[model samples]
Target: MGFPSISKFLFGPLVPVLRIEGIITPNTTNSIGNKLRKINTSRTEGLAVVLDSRGGSTGQCQTIRNQLLQFSKDNNIPLYCFAENFATHGAYYILSAGNTIYVNPTSIVGNASEPQADIDFSQFLLKNQIESRIIASNPLVNEYRFNWAIKDSEKDKKFIQEITDRISKLILGDIQVSRGKNLKVNEELLTKEYTGKQAINNGLADQFGTYEAILAEKFPLAKLDHTSLTQFSFISSYQWNSRFGKAIPLFLLLSLFSLKVFIKYTLIIQSYLLVSSQEEGQEKEKKVQH
Candidate 1:
């Protein structure tokens, strides 16, 4: 048996609960990836992800989804997802990676549509009397400027449409693959937002339940290790010690340098004020004597 297997055999089973909150970004992916890599899979009964995000970065969403799916497969552990408040856009994309998705009765699910590309700030800038300038080596780059008018750019429209199509394909493909025969709705219906009850009915989610209750029912014996995978806990334990170990000294040095500069400037200002006060007093005395 492996070291983790031996350890599990000696102790007991553990269920790792990872909470993903806020906007999904590269850092989110990195934090989750690092935690997954460090998990002792042999002892793990299953992996549970608690998602509470409004969604962000489609590319990051796909990357994180792939990582989660791969981790579950490689570890031979069932992956459970619990959507708390909402999981729209890229968050929904990541949510579809779960083997079994659980949601609260009021949870918002789905809305995996293509992002809107046309974001012209020209009107707003013009109203505020702000003249935005774009200076680029390539003229093609100017076409993408927020201040530039994009009313009649057929090429830009076509390019945006192509990108949206690809993004849609990737997101919808993953959802279909993960949900498989359980997914009841068509592609058109999948793009619409639904409540937790509606989600289960449409096969977007498996059950209407909270994280604690679901985990309690599913893995009754396994202890939930929620802190291990949390960003703050992980950083404090691992990153702070190892990653920032050498950098701490440098940080202190820079802080001390800043403090020294501040003190020198303060002394200079105080001396100038004192000299100015003395000069004014002498001038007033000379005027009185005259």
Candidate 2:
């Protein structure tokens, strides 16, 4: 109360910064969705998303991108994206939602591709004496589970490739639309990987700088309050586990020791009470005899 809380008075309007680090799985997207609901855009000038992910679930990536787009549009606020370390493929998809994308100088940028199967492993299976015969009523469903099926069936390969192409296109489309004249969209650009500097030159990124510095420069009037910003701290299982898991064993041992001490003291008190009662009984008997 003495200084009137600097954040509320000095900063003016705060900008919400969200950090999306590590793998973006279905669970990760759900966590993001929960956090997004908590963000009150009315109190903030703009939203800053700091992305640092290699790549993850394609479907979840699309969901996160769509959600971010909706949040920005609804709030009528600028959504700035800064790649902390790197943002590639699925991560890039989310980054594309930003009005301006920034990356650190050394951060790796793009690598929008899918996994490919190596040569057949039937011989290896035979060598290992492994027998696995997957059966499904539907051909597509069966082929979906069979890794080696792609080698034999052109249709299966095409089917897998088509989905990969679609996911890549989604990333490209967002980047192209967001960056507009800055980005040069092409087949090579979509397939090839780029360094942070290369990404900036190619228009994949608007600038190369830290998220904090960019926010200070871009939104001069806005204050960056990390406490008010949306945090994924609540969603991490490891943090909770590490916090409480370490203490559980120690707590159990202490509890056992305490219980043992309690039992020992109780027995000692019981023994003393029994001896006292016997002495009282002996004294009463002597008086009766007298």
Candidate 3:
């Protein structure tokens, strides 16, 4: 849900490391605001911040960018980007907040700027819905058909293009200013989003390496907090440990029943084999006597 433990101790004569993740937006800022506040003063050789997210609201992106930029300048510590996966959108901008950006070659640093706008627009719609409810409750606009449609063709087109241009510029500027940006991406104004190979060719990511290389280069003693989907747990196991702390009995009963059935079937098979062998031995003795 959030970054683990505002700090981690590292190798090399007591170093400090930090990590960040998720969509970079207002909540992202809120989530880390306390952590950031607590980190007003810390002297260290370098600071490493890792990000793994698809990005979030632009406003949030701007807030985080400004906040981290100030932190880096004020504290005089080098900030780095450890790209674990697709560091897309606002996440990419956060990576730019660092002094150096590192990427795992196979890992993706995606370009999904359009999605960020979609999120902001979703928020705008929610706001409008609330306002519409207020208007319905109010004495105004209930008596007339509100002309929400835009009849101005030229104005609408101009407005649309202006917003498009603004979003494009925001995305372009973020990429251009990234710490790992070796050079400007070709393609005028980035008409299309780039992926791993294209991103590298376009200079979005500086260089790629294995996990070991990346950690050693940036966070020599960085311990990745990772999760795997392969872990399996039986339903009855939950009751035995009571992770929920409720100590439910029904699940445990079902588990024991299943085990008992298995044991019974196994015993039956063993008895059947033993009886068949004894009967065969008697038949052979009768044949020998005859």
Candidate 4:
């Protein structure tokens, strides 16, 4: 009741504004996509899609990207991100799809890199139809198509790197073109690897200001339902405390499992040594008797 309800439309039928402040995934894509489809079909007066997510799946990001591009292009909607605490690689990649990117000076942006290798499907036995399609069309499978569940082959790793490299180049080019000035930008700011001054100096973001200032300039009554607040909006949902080790990446989890296995083996080795020592003592007593 404090802030404006997202359920309540603030603007005209033309402007179907959606906030993307949390994790963006395929599931989220379906929800947002459905809303956009309805809004577009309904013929909204103007559409202003605001993306605020830190980013999620590559496939989902692309899905949102394509939809936004088409919708914005058709309805003259401008997609702009108000870069917050962190907007990393995939986050920045999705923004490039926007016609224009607006950021506060302190807004963190940049740090583009090849998307992390997810899954490998080298031994993947695609059905005849799918295999033939791949062979015939050979879509850019290497770019960002890994399932992360599949083990990657050496060749697959190399291909993935190549595609990520290309995507990185494309993003950097976008930043350069947007800046409209000739300055070398590391182009990795989106990877959560940039400061406000660094972002401005590099030209990844325009200026820095509080949400109040930035939004007021654009959206007069720009009220934000912070993800933290919106999270409680459901009231019926459960909440959990943030744990230090819980945020570790999946690869790290695998590493920890391997380490535990190693420790287990060390204990087994100790047991083997104790048994061997006892056997040797018994054998020595028999030799003395001889």
- Please give the CA lDDT of all the candidate structures: 0.81, 0.74, 0.56, 0.56
lDDT of 1 by residue, 1-290 (tens): 56667645444567888888998899999989988987877778899999988788888888999999899888799999989999888888889998889999999989987675456666777788877555678867635633344342677667667878888877898899889999998888899999999999999999888879888887665567886732222222342355456668988999999999999999999999999999999999999999
Worst 10 residues of 1 by lDDT: 230-239
Clashing residue pair totals per candidate (backbone < 3 A): 0, 0, 0, 23
lDDT by residue for model 3 over 133-251, one digit each (tens)? Answer: 33355543423222233122455446556766687677666656563337465425243445556656766666565444555555433333222111121223333343334434755
lDDT, candidate 4, at 284: 100
Q: Per-residue lDDT tens digits of candidate 2, residues 167-197?
A: 6666676667877888875756655778888
Ten consecutive residues with minimal summed lDDT in candidate 2?
A: 230-239
Ranking by TM-score: 1, 2, 3, 4
- Candidate 4 lDDT tens digits, 1-290: 33333332322122345566677777788876777766532323333445455666766766776787787777665655556665656566666554445565455655656466353443453532233123424645643346443455677778768877887676666555645653345454444456656765665655565444544566543233332222122211111112223435765988999999999999999999999999999999999999
Where does candidate 2 clash, by residue pair? none
| Candidate 4 deviant stretches above 4 angstroms | 1-16, 38-53, 97-107, 118-156, 170-192, 210-212, 219-290
Q: Show the colliding residue pairs in model 1.
A: none
TM-score of every candidate relative to the true structure: 0.71, 0.67, 0.52, 0.50
Model 1 clashing-pair count:
0
TM-score of 2: 0.67
